[model samples]
Target: MKVDNSAIHHSPVAVSGGTLLAALAVAIFSFTFPATHWALGGFGPWTTVTVRAALAAAIAGPCLLAARAPLPDRRQWPAIAVVASGVVLGYPLLTTLALQTTSTSHAAVVVGALPLATAAIASVVTHTRHPRLFWIAACSGTVVVIVFALSQSHGAPTGGDLLLFASLLICAAGYVAGGRLARTMPGWQVIGWALVAALPLTGPAAALALGVEPSRPGGLSVLGLVYLAAVSQFGGLMVWYRGMAAIGVARASQLQLAQPLLTLVWSALLLGERLGAATPLTAVAVLVCVAVTQRV
Candidate 1:
């Protein structure tokens, strides 16, 4: 479902706050792949995915109840399912699998096309037309990501590449659907509701994982898992949905062009990936395209 563009128009201050929230959310999200990379040393991808979701649901459900949030109406259920599946399930499951083989640096660049994917999702959902400049800018940013991958991997594609791309695509779909839902309810509440909706699946899976997996992972690995569940799965989406709701999907998603750059920094610091001189320049160019797209 798409929100009417006219309905989402907000005051300047609101939009600015949304932008800042989006930035904060992206910062939190950028840690996920790197954290997963480390956590995989101790936990299986399925284990990580299920356990994190279940933990998130624990927090989300209680918060929703405490706030006295209204349950979504019948019409909203389908959209909530899409939001829950894509963001809460699909993205984490795929990326956690991918990171077992892929470096965080590689994951960051491949997932860099998120803004373009988001715009494409938005176009389909809203059935809205953009100017010629917007299309050019959107495609240009994607091209830069492709070129970056080639330069990094010596033009070779890996299984992880496909998985991460799929993750980004699913995430873009969730972003669009969640953005639409956020217009009707509080943005944060959409994620909380989605988390609760996921409990039947996640809760059982998490219990099974805990039963089989070793209880004593290293401190860093434990920290990574907690971060993924608490911040990446729950907290980040709260702000991201609000931002998208405030600024409209097309414009706010463009802000995601900045995510990969932040992710790269995380990768370098946490995963020991080299932040080569070439990377920053390419990031700047892609961001310019994002800026242009937002304007057009």
Candidate 2:
């Protein structure tokens, strides 16, 4: 309920603790892909994303109501709406679609490049200058990841892969812009509003899922979906916002460098996909690049 902003600001220890917690949250968020893939094996991609969004909104929605948070200001609404599109709608939709065609490990590798994409957007939109090493890292990391991803591709390009990459770009923009906007509102409040705003769009899609004869998923699939909706989306957002608040967006985005490795680990565990020794090594290279890029 009541956050003591002053207390958190005064204490480096608190900030460090918060950042650590958020890093773990991002790690948890990465596993959602394999979980999603498992779920989609039963439910279609569209249905899975829609239901997840709907459930996330359901969980966070009541908290906003209980706290008596008011509607965002007119200026805030536009930004909130854009973020809602990306987080609530775009990211999930693209990721879900991508998983249908690719393994979760492969998808995680692609998404790992998101920090670089976010940095690129920051340069364009925010005019933030980054170090050359950062670009080197980003470019190198991304190239390797893409190469690996391509190797894993069973055949020629499906429209699905392109769509997934497009979604990544859109979501990257959302991450950059949303981080800025979240500065103005409470982190939870911002996410809560975005979730509600995206409901209308997600609602009809979810309805269509039920209309189709639903394929029955095993317990693992259901568990993964529930974890994705509740923990990854809902719980992850809470910590993410706090971290973003404690340290500005630029610094906060750096945490994403670790996400790909975490996802890779989860992929190995859940999907029985192996990244071998190359995975962690590649992730370290990417992380270094991301760190360099974020420097002032």
Candidate 3:
């Protein structure tokens, strides 16, 4: 009897490719808070969120059209709506608002719990169980992040912290839905359709915000706005959903444990935020947990 061994050979390659894609997505997302800070230098929170979504929709719309992508079936619309509400609208609005009140570094640390939230939500939505070790590692990372957040905030949850937490839940839900949908369709299409679905709301909101909000529109701010729309909103998620589909959602989410650390670096470099001594310690702890979760 001849043994195929083809799947055995390909499994590692597939996993490696997925990990790389997810890590790249994390790299792209790590710039988001800093970019939002720059965007806010010119645009109000409402304008920043609405305009970014609208711009992303504008970009995605043309790509979908050019690709001749068929419209998603009626059954898919509900999931797409969830994706639009959670990621396209809710997450950006909440995070942008939170950034108004909090320093970018503080907000970035607080959002470190996102990986745990994503994994937990993915478990529920995908009806999959992770090993006890996986949960242990994930929980450890979350606890470290929470402690750092508390220390940074002087032991109280500020309004910004609350908003960031809310964003976490909604974004996780959107991620799980998008990941699930990616199994059936192209990952890019998942986000493309979600962006297009959000056009009705985002388009009007953008117009209203531009009129109501004071806009400065410096070179850096304009660059930031464009990055948020083009990369953070559309490009990053395109690969992220693909990675989630390749790896299980729970596994893919654990990769984001490094995102906050990356964000911290960006904050310091881009916004001139000073890092506290605790940051290094927190980075080590988070990385350890990330490694364990990936291994287990």
Compose the digit string of candidate 2's lDDT tens values, residues 1-296. Answer: 22213224537876786677668768777777877877886777777888888888898889998999988898898878877888778888888887777767667766777777877876777665655676776687667666655555654455556766777788887676666676677777877888888888777878888578476788887887788788877777767776676665666677787787778878887788867565566566666766776663
Whole-model Cα lDDT of every candidate shown, in order: 0.83, 0.74, 0.85
TM-score of each: 0.91, 0.88, 0.91
Which ten-residue region of model 2 has the weakest summed lDDT? Answer: 1-10
lDDT top scorer = 3
* CA-only RMSD, every prediction: 2.5, 4.4, 4.0
- Cα lDDT of model 1 overall? 0.83
Candidate 3 wrongly placed segments (more than 4 Å): 1-14
- Writing each residue's lDDT as its tens digit, candidate 3 over 1-296 gives 22112123337778688778888999999999999999999989999999999999999999999999999999898889989989999999999999998988778777777776776776676566667997898889878877877777789878888899899899988988898888778889999999999999999999999999999999999999999999999999999988877775766777887888888989888789988888767876877776776676
Over the full model, what C-alpha lDDT does candidate 2 score relative to the true structure?
0.74
- Clash counts for the predictions, in order: 0, 0, 0
| Candidate 3, number of clashes | 0
Query: Candidate 3 local accuracy as lDDT?
Result: 0.85
Candidate 1 ranges with C-alpha deviation above 4 Å: 1-8, 150-154, 212-216
lDDT, candidate 3, at 89: 95
Q: Alpha carbon lDDT of residue 186, candidate 1? A: 89
